[model samples]
Target chain A: MSTVREMLVELTGTPEFADGISDDADLSASGIDSGDLVRLVLLIEQRTGAEVTAEDMDQLTTIADYERFVATRGGAAAQPNGS
Target chain B: MWLTQLAERNRQCFPDRTALVDEHRSVTWAEFDDRTGRLARGLAGLGIRRGDRVAVLSLDRVEVMETYFALARLGALFVPLNHSLTPAEVTGIAQRTGAVAVIGEAALLDRHPDLPVRLRIAMESEEFAALGADGIALPELPDLPDDTPVAILHTSATTGQAKGVTVDHASFRAIALGWLAVARPADDMVLVNCCPLYHGSMVVSLTYMAAGATVVLMPGFKPQTALAAIEKHRATHIWLVPQMLRFLLQAKAMESTDLSTLREVLYGASPMPVDIYTEAAARLGCGFRQVYGMTEVGGPFVTLGPEEHPAPDAVPDLIPAGRVVPGMSARALDDKGEEAAPGTIGEIVVRGPGVMRGYWDDDEATAEITVDGWIRTGDLGYIDRGGLIHLVDRSKDLIIRAGQNVYPTEIERALRTHPAVHDAAVIGTPDPDYGEVPLAYVVADEGTGTAELLRHVAEQLAPYKRPRRIEFIDQVPRNPAGKIVKKLLRG
Candidate 1:
């Protein structure tokens, strides 16, 4: 299965997210808007079956936060180097 | 009076009263005045002069409001670019407006490094914070006429390309007075505004503050944060789009939250689902007011007061957009450019002091939309015997099937009445037999079949108005202002 980082790159459709994007990079700053953020959360819920509530969505600001959020809920483990 | 004078008035009358509250901090009326004054001087130092257009791109923040007032003080036109726009789009708007300066957060600024503007100020940088330093010398304030252009607000572009609607100082002043006359916000009224500041909806916040009411701003609308802010601030009034209200009703925290202080909830930009309105009115125990207006005709010039709201058990009907507020006159115009008879469906046109001056630098487009000092609202509606204006739908959104007119809103409303249907959007799809047919995109709970929804819609609507297809989707695409982007669905 593709890692969360790869999914974000595909979802945002921004080339900048394909390479050298730190896990801590602000998703909003990387061209992800509020509508895009909502879609990302929905995608995560569909794939991981993790219940990301409205409150939880507010705290997931960076790419790493989403990965950890899914992993903590018993989803797939993060790949080394996020390849 | 211009926005600068309004701020100064608030400072003198309610100096110590809270004027603005964001997530991080709150500011008093006096402090807000002082900050804008210094920021105005700082901007002048950057060579921004009267009539200059300055594009601002940033998230909701205290600094954004500061920039608006500061620019208004200098008689410069504030051009707010929607932050969600791509870099190319931002550059395009800046070029179109001939903006000489761009002020925004660092990340947004960095995205468009080659913006045509001559000056760029990052709001997060020390350079920006120092713009409001007390030590900065204040420039002599300009005595701007009320007709001077203040801001160019871009339309939401739900239908097509966004156009910059030029609004003057007189427009805002008229809107403020009109809104105050209708809303009659009390002195102690505290408003929690849930819409983004970039959109024209910011005028609603300014209108409340004009009455010495305190306004709480959010970075963006999140159901949980909005509930918390209302509870923590004891907000007496809240402004949001109907979609936001829906999310608030669905949020897990809503039931546990203390909402006794809420007296009125203002909603607009689209019709409220009768089911949602009934549920909210019962649970929150607050009066609901519907505001109606277009970007071209200032922000909001008509209001459906709380008393006019339908009873919880009342059957859903075509709710009146409202009677035109003071200082504005609205009438339905027939296709021949003549006034339509009462109860006749025609294009709604409004004339008032609050109407926009024109579309920025697009004289042809401006001329096309205006007639005899009246701005065409592009909405089809009619005035009733009681002098209430009822909106039918956007002229472009009306679907014609077999030479019969079919309003998508009517069908969408019918589909929404289904127990399992969460939301629906109807659009015209080209058909060979019928030039166009109504097609629906619906977001519904699991196990809700298209056949079941079709049957429900058929029972409520005429045969011609029923959507030929009901496609299930996870969500209906909408613009930031909560209007369905039907263009996306049609594509």
Candidate 2:
């Protein structure tokens, strides 16, 4: 299982995602299309052991918001190091 | 009002000047017009009639010149079939259009190809031998209206069955006039052409030749041969697709070749990125024009001006599809059929002389898009305050959720922006409750885990626009014409 940030980091293959970029950055405003976001949703489902319905897809607004949803929905617990 | 007017006017003005060149072969206006008159008679002798359809299928040769002009003279429709398409496809088009004759040389008949045309004949290798053997009286062209049907071009059938688009003399005249207003074909300029004669760009070039510039044609798009010809003949101009531009830009002698003779390069048939355009402009050393048009409307209705290229303001503004030339008008309309405000997304509607008469024999579909006289292009996008058209996607490919429109193009654009995503396609999937939701298929440049993707984009999109499902594929399914085949994915 991988953290939401880790999953985002993997699909985007950007180290900044792994390290962390602002969750509020506009994904489209940041240049991400719904296609890339869809891949991200699939990654969340696989890593977090969560069933993400298409209806559930709309509830997410930012990386932090998504991570919290995954956490509440029993997504992967973060690594031992808080950092 | 007539196709012959283009050549006739030019022949009167430049009769002794070479009007066409191919493989060291050149045809002057005087010779082309005089012989084409006889060839029209030859075709008429073989029963090609006014408003008849003649299908030309062969390697690029001198006879094609005679074929085009002969048909133009008689007001018969000329159907240029792609030599690269499968024989079955050829047969299907021939059957659908009910062509009067399918003319080929010895090589094209090698596979014992069967066509649904009324007659089939193979011309000799010399091409001109037919003229010497049987001298037929040149048939005087009949008086025909510009609105008269001149050609029946088949739609690419990228998504489904091919439909014939009726191009009238008005449409042809409008296209040539509008293009010349910008391309400004030089009478003495040697135009090197390699696109298949069936394609719209090739036909446009034919009109340019008909306008009197010497035409240098190729059998087909062959990169090596194109380079050789450019070098050997000093071809002054070339028309190509973006893919061809990329290749031409890479030719070994591109920079060093005595390209001083080269004057302009015309490219269309697909959307191109800004970077590619910039590179091509700098390297090719010619004015670049982007053409945008569909089969229903006379092609290339809009083009981005040459001044827009590689400029600082080119971003988002330099749409390769230039502004609509004079006489034609464009409006972006929403689903309800009302005009969209500037920068608002909607389907594009066009009206002008260039608009096709209608889809040949498909009245039901014709009535659906064409209303009054405006052709409703299923393409979705917006017009800026300056009146430039920006394409988003076909209206059929739109995904609606809770009454909100989610354009797949916007989503696909987002996906391509990702560092790892090489390509992406977003389509609407059936939703029991909401009626539909978007599903995305991605092709990635590198192996990546899903968690990182979720973290990066989960917060970036609105709830309705988000993709509920995702899948990775080796490559998107595209038809022979390189357009993504979403219908196949739904199947």
Candidate 3:
């Protein structure tokens, strides 16, 4: 299972933009623009095969927050489609 | 002071129309006034008086609606706290602003347990039910002066430290009035608002209540629910950020939906990829007006109007945010204080009735931007020969390409056209010969590569203009406010 941050990295191409973000960096403080956040959230859902909604967005302030959100909601059927 | 006063002005002409709505809740002008008057009297009865700052920590509900005008009726400053803020962060702002009261959502006492204060006038659904469930009270009131401090909206805290923008009634009124001139609110002009009430865009939408407009309130934006609200309400005016714009673009029915009632969409909060702007028009019949203004000036001072770009030029060059509004004074100036000749990029400085009085208690920092009363916009832009302003970037975000300037906005706009590229950021990475080269940190859809992106960019740019290096990432770094923090990228 991929970490939520790893899921974010893989889906969003996070390495290009990971310079200053810490695991502790507040989503607002880390400088991830809304555009990036939208893409990252979509990617997590796709990778985990979990349904995410805006109401579910409350806990998405950190990678840990996303991990806990998706990891909990995701199960065996939650895996991304295999080629 | 503004919302309350405007509501009164509107009640005289259109009081019976629906003004505010949520799930299972709706308030008409007459109902709104009765409750607002009662609430203002209620707060006044509790010794909440003029100039007292009240922090509202609640979801977007009718109670929050009453809070805005009720505070305005008493000449108090309204501070709408972002519910998304951590308890500690909320407490920090509350302490810093010296708020006299924080009226929270009556049910959410458990959510924000550590706001550093105990005084809260909680309002909840059941309480509101009891409030007007039988009969609402009407209280006598008079118009408050326009200069009264109506709100202290905090900055988005995207790039640097967050600052409080002390917006006076007059400044707030100027913006709403400006919007009124173009974006009219017919009783049938249903609006779907998903942004936080704290942000000016939501406030702008809520102000349509003054005009008897029906508003579909989505406490926060959920892509599915946002789509549902539009279909149900036949919303005409939808407020959006670019990220939300993308979500709308991706919606299944976006192109096929009966968006006939949709007239115009107002989008801001962050600069968007121009391609995304195109997708919005294609997906929804809504012609968008891209607002370009900062929190200090309250908004939409310069906008890319619905008209297609003048064809003498192409794309963004043709699509520079149109001329300044009637009362506003705008100029592009170089460091030497001389007016930049048309087409010469310089700092955008604005002076007008719409500009805020100053940052709250930040005279020194305020002084740096306000030189002889003209607010230095900090954004680098230029006015063309046709008097339209084209933004380059924020002063700090300017990327020097060899000697030429490469605004990340320009590069981002270019990179968005490639079918495989999702997003891109251009930064000045240190180099030997050029001192600094424009390095592109790019995010591709899935399998796209740096070589393909470089070739894509190379086709559109000169040797000096093309990105010298590429960093592949899963995503670009952005703050909660939807701004790319170059400082973090450099780090």
Candidate 4:
């Protein structure tokens, strides 16, 4: 099972795109566009059964924020593949 | 007296009333008018003049609306660039339009450093903020004629290039009056517009504002954000695409969202699935209006009003595109260019005061799409006995993914650029989420793989335009004249 960080990295289509990126960096500024953000939210929901609310979207501006969100929602723990 | 006077009239009538709202701030009608005047003067100080073309690229924001009104005040043509386009595509459009100036967000401007424009204004720069400063005097605004072109909206071409649709002040004014007559919006209407301001759908926002309604603009459409906005602002009306409506329906927020204030939901750009429409209508307890039109014509000349919507439990019938609005006329023409009888499917064409002036600088292409004064809609439809337009299919092989147009020829052209790709054909396949998604059939050289082709196309096209799946085929079936037979491929 891929971690939240791994899924975030995969969204960029290459690891180098997310490499050296700070946890506090704005994902939109770091090449994650609005479309990608929507797709990421959908992916997290499908994989972890976690709900990202409208309030959460306003605060989820950085990678660290998203990671913290998933962890709090009980999605950070690894599960079996295709679970 | 179309756009410029509309702003002035709003200020005069309701100075304290909120005119525009975005995530950052809300502006009153008076403040909005004052800002537009100052920005127009600032742009004039930078050498922008009447009749000059200026390209604007930005996400949905109050500044985008300000720039549009500012340019319209000066009688300059506002050319809105789709933010999703590659740098090369942006450059191509900027060059073709002979744009003299470009204004956009700092980040978006950074991506297109080589755009063929004499001046660039970053919306977030200190200079940009100073554009609306108090000291600069407002320039003498142009007294634009009704026929003066105000905007150039680009539509993806069948030939893989983009064509600019030139629309004049009169076209918009006609559309506004016609829509007002049909919609009869109340003075207290508060609308949450989900469509991006760059596209032709901006007309909806502009038209609502002309009637002194408050419009809330989102940077982009997120289902949760949209639902929250509707509740927060007590929005009386909302406009979005059908796919967006689907997302909003599925959003977790929908369960707790207060939607009692929503009076109407306007959807367009693509057909609304019957099941989704029925479910949404029942749940939201709001009327649904389906607007139908194209960029080549003005935004929307036909509408399926809420009264015309079928009962939820009734046997589902084909939902018509609706009756033509005031100031517009439509008919179906047979292959021989004669008007088809009622109930006969044929190429739908429309004539109206809102029809676009012409394609920018392409008389031949413009002539091809226009028959007499009517614009060919490229949709196959027929008028029923009740005078409603019922669409059967699209004559053009254009794929609409989630509300954005994805031209198959453009994708095919990008595929052919790959070294190993011999030939490619693309078609639209139905999807439960997005109305349709592109499926590609490829004839490639030995050892070529889907990943390689997908990567190559990714570099050339936007994310939405990319193919969902590629199937290796022996050959792309074509006629003796070398025209691709997409029907066979669909089978």
Candidate 5:
């Protein structure tokens, strides 16, 4: 199964994430807007069966933060490097 | 001499009062005054002179407003670039404005390296803060006429190219005071500004400041953050577009957030969805007002104050386009240019100091929109016996998706750029989340598919401006005049 990082990289379509996005990479600074965030939540929920609450979505500013959020809800354990 | 003078007056009158509070920090009226002054001196030090255009590109922040005031001090025009635009689009705007300098976030500068400007200042760098650091004396404010253009706001036109709205100090001053006269905001109101800095922030926040109220600035409107800011600041008033309010109401945080401090909720930009309006009014337990105006008219010139909004479920929809504010006159003109009888639908025409000087460098287009000192608002509405304007339809071929204006011609122009396309017509379809979203009907080459055409238009326009869906058609319907009959496309 594709890792969370892989899904994000694919969704963003930015090749900079080809090497795998860092756990701490700021998603908002990377141009992931609120609309994009809403889409990302749906993708994560579909892949991991993790329901990201609106409150959790507000706190997940960085990639690692979101990975941890999904893991807590029974998603795949984060592989920061997509190894 | 300029609108910034209000900031100066506020600094003296309420020196120790909180002027602006961002997520990072807060600045008092005195500091806000001093910082903007220093930044003006810094820009002047860069050899930027009066009448030079300075483009500012950034997400909503206090520095953006500071830059606005600083430019006003120097008599320079503020060109706010919508950050959603592509780099090429940004460059095009900068080139058109002939900007002497550009101040933006680091990522923006990196994205648009080709921006034609003599000076580029990165907001995150020490170079930016040093502009307002101590020891550099502030320069004297420029002596300019009230009609001196202070801001150039670009609004999308029917022609597909964005038309720049040149607003002068007189217009801002008039709109700010006139809004207060009409809206009658409570004394000592603390406002949380949740809308984008580029849009109604100036008219709303500045007007509150003019009334000696503290205006808290949100970097961007995330529903949770917006709620937190209001509760934390004990904010008494909040200004937002209906779309943002919808997000706030959907947020789970709304269930628990202490929004008791909120007294007045000002909503506009697009018509408020009745469901969202009713739900928000009940949930927040706050009085709601509807504002109706446009960027071309120097922000809001009409308001349906809280008293006018009926109790929830009192009517199918209680939304009113609002009545003209003091110093503004409105008349609904029929197709023959005569006044429409009361309650008869006609184009809403407005004449006021709030009207813009003219579209920047586009005389023909400016002439088209204005006639006899009255600006054609492009809105079809009727005035009731109560003098409240009720919007029945928008005659402008513009789609308002989530409060952002999307011109069909602009999207159609982008869709035609695809090599596999023949012709395209764009129309607005009703949406639940957004008031309306664009729907594109296309007659395309045999090989082209929906996904390919979608991606093609996405590349040329901002995300909000792109069509939500594309329908393949045999041919685009047009009249003998060769104009696409958009109404048929809607059918």
Candidate 6:
């Protein structure tokens, strides 16, 4: 399955741009603004087959945080695509 | 002191005037000054002090601008991180600057757990809100020299590392003053800034605020949301790159939204397509001006005024970068550094108070670009007999996508990281919507497929920086010194 970071790299369009990004780094610093973040959350929901809400975004500051949140919303379809 | 005084002077002169507005909130000049003062003290209590490098990561918000002014008040350097960069790129900058703290929204901070900093203050968390909620006494604001560094604006280099452009209060103030003198924005003009707040927006938004106008900030550009904001606020001015302008013109809201309130549209970063320009002009019936500047040279230092926009019948192949704005001078220098004759193409160079102090910790780069006092812009253009600056090409391998600068070397470096790739070269191909997009040429190992290479690049780079197409070749031409002949690839 593709990692959340992998998904971000695809969505954002910079090949080496996200290479150094870690789970706790500020995504905003990586140029992911609110609108991008909103879209990212929706994409995560689609791929994981889980509900990734705005409140979840407020709570999940890192991709690691999103990964764990998606884990909690467990199901067979909750796996990220290409995993 | 120059930047800090902007808020203080505005607050004293028009305390109740709305200074800034975003989707969530608005702040009057008085409230802005008081809050920033308190926030500065709060940051001080957290050990932020003079000369501190504070990095801010957030979307477009009043707090972001507040942090900018607050950091200036404390005589600390503000490093506004671009939200679109990768974590490594962000960390590289934060580390390069030795940022004392990274203040941003919690989600952003969460993404980069590895950013080395003394503190990670969540701008929206209860802890941070409490810091501002307590009516803490304002700290002593510093009276900085005009040349004191206020910000470190980052821009990409062909070397794959971003360079930080050190800007002083004087340079930033010069930009605001120069913009005011040139643009002559209405005192009550309400500007809808549709770009990210990290870079050029600072020039556009603050320039308006310096003129005692209110600025409405959009966190990110969405054609519909931008139109709604303009219609809702009765915004008189709007700032966008040509790509966003095209998207806005295509937005469904364009059919019904009342856009008569818009008086001026400022575009820059890349040249606007002739068709897009014509349609936008006809639809908005507003004056359009093109801005030409770079982060390395403070911010915007020149402008193509509304009257100078190309006629519908005229070919927009080489739109002028426009005349130098107030407080700046321009020259087109030949190979030997002599000024190029009018109508002769040369490197576009600028010298002005708005020029940056230098690249942070990059003396070699600083020296290479700054000859005597002029900032070598690296754009190939000529000064026409009528004194208009027309751009023909870029001497530097810089590709402007929409309005964003994308360096091919950075992408080429990413392609080389794949095991199957022997060598890669990237070049810009023109596009109607984005102006230009990267097209990559690859020399790969046996059995390496284009799909595999594409996926490899897609995983490493941001979406915009990724190669739109990959062309496989038997060999890459190079010189004796081993530099790839990019011209042959383009051919």
lDDT of each: 0.79, 0.67, 0.67, 0.85, 0.79, 0.80
Using lDDT as the measure, the top candidate is 4
Worst 10 residues of 3 chain B by lDDT: B309-318
Backbone collision count in every prediction? Answer: 0, 22, 18, 0, 0, 37
TM-score of each: 0.78, 0.67, 0.71, 0.94, 0.91, 0.85
The worst-scoring run of ten residues by lDDT in candidate 2 chain B lies at B454-463
Best by TM-score: 4
Q: Per-prediction DockQ, in order? A: 0.08, 0.01, 0.10, 0.33, 0.14, 0.08
Where is model 3 more than 4 Å wrong at Cα? A1-83, B106-109, B125-143, B156-161, B183-187, B253-257, B309-318, B397-491
> B1-491, model 1: which lDDT tens digit per residue?
37888899999999999998988789999999999988988898778999999999887878889999999999999999877665655777888899999999787788779999999999888988888477666577688999999999986333324579999999999999998998887889999998778788788888898888889988766777788889999999999876678667756568778999999999886666666788888888789888887778888988999898887878376668888889999999998989999999999999999999999988988998899988988889999888899888667566644323456877787788998988899999875334567789999999988767765664445344567777899999999999999989989
CAPRI classification of candidate 3:
incorrect
- State the lDDT of candidate 5 residue by residue for B280-380, as single tens digits: 87777778877787887888888888887877767455477778888888889999988898999999998888889998898898899887878998999
TM-score of chain B of 6: 0.96
Question: Residue by residue across B364-410, what tens digits does model 2's lDDT show?
Answer: 77888786678987777889888777787666666654223466765
| Tens-digit per-residue lDDT, B1-491, candidate 3 | 67776677656766777777876588887778767767777666566778888889777776787788888887878888766554555776788788878887754556666666546767764543343233545344546778878888876332223467888878867776665665544557777776668765555564565556777776655565576677777788787666676776664435445667787676665555556666566656456766666667765577666664332213452346666765677899997987899988898998887888777777776787787778887788899887788887767555543223345665676677899888888887764323456778888877787757756664444334557677888888998998887777888
B243 Cα displacement, candidate 5 (Å): 1.6
Off by over 4 Å in 5: A1-33, A36-59, A62-64, A73-83, B137-139
TM-score of chain B of 1: 0.81
Chain A TM-scores for all candidates read 0.70, 0.68, 0.71, 0.76, 0.66, 0.72
Model 6: residues >4 Å from true position, as ranges? A1-83, B132-138, B311-316, B458-460
- Global lDDT for candidate 3? 0.67
- Alpha-carbon DockQ of candidate 5: 0.14
Residue B488 error for model 2, in Å? 14
Better of 3 and 4 by TM-score: 4
Pairs clashing in candidate 5?
none
Tell me the lDDT of model 2 at B400: 51
User: What ordering of candidates by TM-score runs from best to worst?
Assistant: 4, 5, 6, 1, 3, 2
Ranking by DockQ: 4, 5, 3, 1, 6, 2
Model 1 over residues A1-83: C-alpha lDDT tens digits? 33667666655443333354677888766544353454466456556655556567677888788878877973563333322
